[model samples]
Target: MAPTHSDHHHHNDGKKPPPKLLTLPTILTIGRVAAVPLLVATFYVDSWWGPNATTVIFLAAAITDWLDGYLARKMKQGTAFGAFLDPVADKLMVAATLVLLCTKPFEAGVFGQAPWLLTVPAITIIGREITMSAVREWAASQDGKLSEAIAVNNLGKWKTATQMTALTILLATRDGSLIGEGTLLASGVVLLYISAWLSAWSLVVYMRKIWKVLLM
Candidate 1:
């Protein structure tokens, strides 16, 4: 019989295995976390790049969020640490960007003339993230699978999609870099509210699933 691919694996019998924390996927995940500081620095650069640079950097970092997971699964490089850190990286990106836009008071308001519009959506999204993280952490400390049950769902993914897109657009508007009409800021604000709605929906779903467990 011909030698099979698996049969060739015996050649590495003497080698030490690499550390779990050093995998390529995990490295990419770490890069995403590091990008947050870079993003913040770009905001204060005081140059032509301004929010334009942030938009590009933020978009790249956001893409890494999906790319890291895809590479992890495709390369079979997933680790326990990678699983834990990936979502933490994601939450950090979203929360930091939203807080930057909402509190910085860009031109009187971050996205709109109405003070509460941007504030409400930012708070909604941020609050839901913090709450869900606490809930999932507590659930994991109890029953391991309990957290997985309420883990990232379709709605949660949609919330991230909308949230990332909205923030990207909102930031772009700050430097007068709108892709279309002058109403891009307003559009971003509207999408932010939509994302927040989805954020709230996902939180409610997670809480309902674990409410009984939490009561005990």
Candidate 2:
């Protein structure tokens, strides 16, 4: 028997809506991920414009990071996919930039022949990111209280700000032309260490919050 018009309408109404995957926030998050390869390609350019280009790309991605979150809240376009993709994009860009910084002209130019200076903070920041990501995943699988306890805090914000600034300065000074090598590079290194410290501190705070749940 053929269904009546009213029955068809009711059937459509009862079905679950599809996930919103192409919203503006998700698009911006995807753009951030797309920028990663471009950022890396700049490292091989070996021209006066290379470092500047890398800086611009990194800065643009960083701006989009904030812009997407703001728009997501203001426009009510947030999605589960966006929430997941956003941090993955940020971590990819940061990890890639840090790895590149420890290579080539940057290794000697930015760190003054001491790769460990950059290496230590780079490893710390990356390790913290990895560990926290795992913790968040584990928390998500448990009771709701675990997730709440491990939510983002102000310290994470400060760490991101400091880390982004440090990377931008280091990228711009790769060839040492933007604002002289010594002072700017030193400033970047200092900020990076501070960022790493913040990362570790925040990780410890998160673990302390969830330790009881894990012990069970």
Candidate 3:
């Protein structure tokens, strides 16, 4: 009875695809992605660098997360390529750190090593990221502007802040920068679990919003 939005997009031509990838904002995003391997390598490899190296590098990279977005807006260089690459880099960093935390687990006395609890949060965070990416792609294919309906919201920002803070603190546990080991590592785990909870809540919110639009 009704043509889908996908049918309408086929006839449209106004919105432009991303231009060349030479923009400063795009370069910053690319740099963020590039640092991911070094982040993981230093964290596990240990011998190559000092104890707190991962924490310092991670927090530095996290700063770029905000800087790139701010520059993209201030510099007027918000290309589709930057939009896509930014989140991909963030998710890559989060996933790598989560794997390390899960493998190591939280070190509580009676509880011993509880890798499964760490794993639950990792799955929750990664699964939500994957689901939202697919939704955005499909919505864009339907109507180029529709995907913005579920773009990064405030809740997503909180989730990311908690994620970055927790991951950085966890990595810092290798040294007593902020009094690590029991105190800092435990706090990091608690914050991470909180971020994971927020991640699930945000996922539900986005899915509901998109579902209503999809059915229309």
Candidate 4:
């Protein structure tokens, strides 16, 4: 016997609904955010593995930062919630790590000679994140055009890459026994400064894009 259209429709209704929130990509993003506390806890371990553990945790979180975005696109699971949460997680992680590095006392390392070296870039990077976050929120409140105008650019990507590399190196070398302790610490500081410059440059570009819209 041939099934009627009504019968087919009834059958389809029993199927599971598509996932909105809590998808794989979204879970990965949440995992990255959850890692923040674990990373912080590593600092309190008071053992040889403290720095190494933090470095590993941070590296894993950084990798997921890239992976989640790729999966979101490839799996066609991109969502507004994921988009909003992703950047928040990244900023939180970076800001927290920078603050920890700046505050933690070290007997001998790049910051040992002059703490301001790390403090300056840390402030610049964190300040840029805060300012840009506010700018993004304001743009979203305005017409859609403003938001589009200030979309992420190449400079922003480079800044993130360099910043992550710098933080990872700094974390691993905090104990001063990772690899060529002196050279690595110096290289990390240099990279951090570069990332700070890139952050400022990207912020300027974003502001310029929305300046006209803001006036109107």
**Which pairs in model 2 have colliding backbones?**
none
Quote the positional error of residue 133 for candidate 1 in Å: 1.0
- Each model's TM-score? 0.84, 0.88, 0.81, 0.89
Which tens-of-lDDT digit does each residue in 1-216 have in candidate 3? 799986667558546553667688788889888988888777776463544677777887799989989999998889888988888988898888788767765455334767586788899998888887887778778774467667778998899999999888877775444543677777777888999999999988888888777787
Tens-digit lDDT string for candidate 1 (47-136): 988788888988988898889899999999899999999999988988888878866655533334565667888889889888887877
**The candidate that achieves the highest TM-score relative to the unseen native structure:** 4
Error of 3 at 35 (Å): 0.9
Better structure of 1 and 4 per TM-score: 4
Write one digit per residue (lDDT tens) for candidate 2, span 1-216.
898987777768967556678899899999999999999898779888888899999999999999999999999999999989999999999999999987753544544667478889999999999998888888999899899888888999999999999999888877867656778888888999999999999999999889876676
lDDT of 4 by residue, 20-100 (tens): 798888898899899999999996788999988999999998999999999999999998899899999999899989999
- The local distance difference test score of model 2 is 0.89
Per-model lDDT: 0.81, 0.89, 0.80, 0.89
Residue 102 lDDT, candidate 2, scale 0-100: 78
- Residue-level error in angstroms, candidate 3, position 30: 1.1
CA-RMSD of model 2: 3.5
Model 1 misplacement above 4 A: 1-13, 106-112, 179-181, 212-216
Give candidate 3 misplaced runs (Cα > 4 Å).
Answer: 1-20, 47-50, 109-111, 143-148, 175-180
